[model samples]
Target: MQTPSAADLLLAWERGLDQSPTRRALSLLEACLPGVTLDRLAALPIGMRDTQLLRLRESLFGNSVAAVSECPDCGERLDVAFNTNDVRHMSVEKIDAETMEPQTQAHQLHTGGYDITYRIPTSSDLLVISTADDIEPQLALLQRCLTEVQQNGIPVQANALPDSVIAAISKDMANADPQAQIELGLVCPECSYAWNALFDIAAFLWNEIHAWAKRMLHEVHTLARTYGWREADILAMSARRRQIYLELAQT
Candidate 1:
């Protein structure tokens, strides 16, 4: 069986983004895997996606990626080198199937002085959230996604819930699951300035793709110049043979 290539996974994600253009662009740049359904992609663990993207970038580009940042306090600029292999080796906790169900009842009960339940956001929940037009609707959708059941005797309705009730539910759900939150922290070594860094997966993946394309293009150019070969022919050469040709050309 042929293992799925990075390109194949990328294409699948692209095809899955029919409802939202923002999501489509995000998926392409993030290099998110194609789920069985569009909703499943949203609930996917962010760390898992980050790990996969890093591995894919390394396969296409090189191991080392330069990360540049500006210090928030002193306006000092710094460049940090990150190894894709190190990222690949980092441990990520996966959400189990037992906690995958939506928490509709819990949120409804929380409004009536009952305890609420919450679960990690899944790819599907993200899809629903992304489609929401306003903050209230978004909160409602989130509540519906996270609320598993209510400790109170009140019955939960998956549909026909009011906006205010949904907001309350979302708040209760968020309070229940601290682990669902994603954080990016950065500390400045010089000034001791601390800031929450924005780690955008889409932007990172796009940078990797652009870098890989440029490097491959450069290799193709070198091969064509040295051997008088067509671009297509050069690209078709095995990576090992290409390296050997490049070495021979230099000598």
Candidate 2:
């Protein structure tokens, strides 16, 4: 999918203001990936989905991702900066010819006298589990992804697995899809308390897009008030051109 146009991105941001992060991410992908179905976006593995969002973010904004975290010991805020490529998982996802999207393979694991074949969790899986009542999200995700389970050559349900076995499967899943669980190792300069932080690309990118859309709306309003240009006309103009006009209008 190509980089989304400003108009398309603005619309996506507007529509996503009330949606969940998962739905927002899928919507953003749908806006950018023309001809791709929402079902396909929902089917994307979380890691692959985040990888694509990271690429789009780098293209739209820049290579650097900035985050703020508070120190646990001293309540001091720290600014963490990293390049987009740094957190990207090393696994190379091959593109599917039919859908023009990345194709993911099922992973197999053998642990605690159990054998299992499972696929990575997708957005749809997360969405479905999130709304269900009286269910552990993690366990629900595990159950959804597990395509087949066998214990000592006997088939069994995922929920029947013990905690240790489930933990092992979770660890294996994390290892296989590193991008799905990004933990930033951070040390506070004030207190020297070291900790790990999760950097969610979907939320981060959506925040950026939201901010950009807000700023663009202000610029559009200014230009329209000063020069009477249409909103569509202003957005259709190049970013550089629009900025120039905004400057002139403000002056």
Candidate 3:
């Protein structure tokens, strides 16, 4: 994906304002990775999509990701910080080192007299499950990813399989697509409560963009009012230059 310019991100944020979280992330990818169709991006395995979003976060902010959560036992605030590489754990080819592209591959699971072939989930799979009111979302996702199912060397339906086999599929999927989910282990200093926190790079990156766009817009307002500069001209200035000009405007 191409690195997004400030103006490009601003446009993406605006377009994503009214969208759901899934669609919001798609908006960012669409703006940054031109020539890639939105449908193709949506079809990307969730981990690959997240890898791209993580790259975007590193580019716009930095490698360090700082976050806060409350302890469940004591309600104490826990501050967590880590580097981007922490969550980037997957096979080198599965997640390309140079291009950061994800390779989607089908995997096999043989257990409880069942043999199953499945692929990692994509954003499109999530969208389909989200809109299906008649089925359990998790079950729907599992069935959607199941490319083939067999029992006793005979073809079988995924839903007919035992829950144990279903769980095996889930576990294998997690292993195959490590970047799709990230959990941070945290221990509260007060109560010593320990728990795992889920980290979503797409949400995290969007929030950073949201805060930055607000600050930049405020700076633009200040400069526009002070010197009658156009929005385009204001956005064209380097961030450091904008900060200097804002300081001058205030003075």
Candidate 4:
């Protein structure tokens, strides 16, 4: 997929405002990756989906992803910066040629006297699970993703699995797909405490896109009022050109 132009990103940002984060992520990818169908993109594993977002994010913004979090112990806020490469788990070999999307391998585990076969959860699974009013979303997700299960050489019901077995499966899934959830080690200078901060790529990228789209809308309004330019014309201009025109309009 080619890099999204300024116009393309602006349109995506506008379209995503009314969408839930899951839907917004799909919209962003659809805008950037026209080659891949929406269904195929939705079927991609969460980690693979995130790998694509990280690529698009790097292209549109930059490699450095900056974030801030409050220290749970001391209540002090900490600034964190990391590169896209840090959390990316999909290697070049797993990328499919036709879709240009990362493909994840199926995993099997023998634990707690049960043989479990599963694949990494996909965006489709996430969308369904998130909409469910479950007390524990992870358990619900595991239930949906459990492709096959056998205990003591006999078929077993996935829902009837015990909490201990579920925990084991969850741990194994996390190890097998590291990129599905990213946790950063954070230190609080004031309290001398350290904690692992969970990072949500979908939320972070959507926040950034929302801010950018608002700023671009303001610029478009200014240019449109001053020079009678269409929104399309304003968005079509390169970022450099738009800034130059904004400066001229201000004068």
Candidate 5:
């Protein structure tokens, strides 16, 4: 995927303003990968989809990612800095030419007198669970993921599985797809407390894009007022040229 032009960025930013987080992320991906259907992209395993987003993020922004979160124990804010290489636990092999689908290893686990075969949860799976309220979301996720489940050499219902069995499946699923949920080790200097902060790349990237769009709009406003240039003209200028104009406008 190539870096988005100023027009593409602004168009995406405007379109994503009223969209849900999932929709916003999908829009960004759509911008980078033209001709790829959203349904096909959504069908990819969450980790696989995130790997693409991370790559796109690195291409558009940079490799370094800085984040801040409050310490649950003491409410102290902690700053964490890392690179894209740190959280990337999975790699995409070649895409299938005929199907255009990414190849991934299916994971299996044997526990609690049962054998389970499953694949990592896809964005479509998460979208389904996001609307579920009848059962626990985790259990719903597990049920959706179970491709095959056998107890005592006989097939058993996934919904009827015991809590212990479900817990085991959860642990194994997490191990198999580490990129699904990224947790950061954070320490608070003020209170000597530590906690794991959930790092969501989609949300983090959206926030950065939103902030950038707002700042760009402000710059356009200032420049337009001073020189009567159109928004498109201002955005079309290179970042260096825009900075120079902004500085000159400040005088």
Candidate 6:
């Protein structure tokens, strides 16, 4: 079978925006089935899309990414090199089914505090959050989607649930997943300024996609120039063969 082209994979990724991240990632894999799927491209199990995009960026661009940052504490300008290869090659394990199943069970039990009642926010959940008019409504919606049972030990009807209940549910879900927790973790070197840094998956994914898109375009330019090929042709080249050609050209 003819391997699907990189362009094909990219197109698939683009089409996945309307879908949940998990669904989108799953779709990306299906589109490249029998050759390369999104699942195989991911280095970690239950991988964030941003992480997958980092892998794609490293595959297309050399390791070091020029990263620029401004310190909120000291107002100091910081410019440093970020290693894409390190980011891409970072070890990750798949969330075991047993572990995931328990989370579901915990959601059902509602025995834990508000923190333990919510499910992990999925791609689908994010979509609902995005459409909410404000943070309160968004949080309410997230809780509504995640809350499996009410405090009264009754299964909540999703559409009929009260906003207050939804808010409580959201708080509960947030407590359940430490990995999903966002907290501040920065200490300013100069002024010793401390601030909270929110680690949000949505924001991370956006930045990753932005970086990957730029890197892929760069690869298109390089391969097109070296081989006198069209963008489509260059993208079609396997990473191995492309590297071999680059080596031969240098020689």
Candidate number with greatest lDDT = 2
**Candidate 1: stretches off by over 4 Å:** 1-43, 58-65, 82-114, 136-141, 149-152, 155-185, 221-232, 243-251
Candidate 6 local Cα displacement, residue 219, angstroms: 3.7
Which window of ten consecutive residues has the lowest lDDT sum in model 6? 96-105
Off by over 4 Å in 6: 1-5, 16-70, 77-103, 108-118, 132-135, 146-171, 182-184, 225-227, 238-251
Which whole-number lDDT from 0 to 100 does residue 101 have in model 1? 23
Clashing pairs in 3: none
lDDT of 1 by residue, 180-242 (tens): 332345678789788865544445656555565566678878888888999767766677888
Q: Candidate 3: where is the Cα deviation over 4 Å?
A: 92-102
Model 2 accuracy (lDDT, Cα): 0.88
User: 1 or 5: which has the higher lDDT?
Assistant: 5
Give per-candidate clash totals.
13, 0, 0, 0, 0, 8
TM-scores of the candidates in the order shown: 0.56, 0.94, 0.92, 0.93, 0.90, 0.53
If both were scored by lDDT, which would come out higher, candidate 2 or candidate 5?
2
Model 2 stretches with alpha carbons more than 4 Å out: none
Maximum-TM-score candidate: 2
Question: How well does candidate 4 match the true structure in TM-score terms?
Answer: 0.93
Model 4 whole-model lDDT (C-alpha atoms) = 0.84
Worst 10 residues of 4 by lDDT: 89-98
True-structure RMSD, every candidate: 6.7, 1.6, 2.0, 1.8, 2.3, 7.0
How far is 25's C-alpha from truth in model 6 (Å)?
7.1
User: TM-score of model 2 relative to the true fold?
Assistant: 0.94
* Tens-digit lDDT string for candidate 4 (48-152): 778778878888888999999999998998889898888777543276856856656668999888999987888888788888995478877877888889988
lDDT of 3 by residue, 1-251 (tens): 67787788899999888988898888888877877778888988888888888878887888998899889888898889999998887643365444434576778888888888988898889888988999888789988999888887799887787888878888888888878898888899898888988898889888989999998889989999999999989998888998999999999
What C-alpha root-mean-square deviation, in Å, does candidate 5 show against the real structure? 2.3
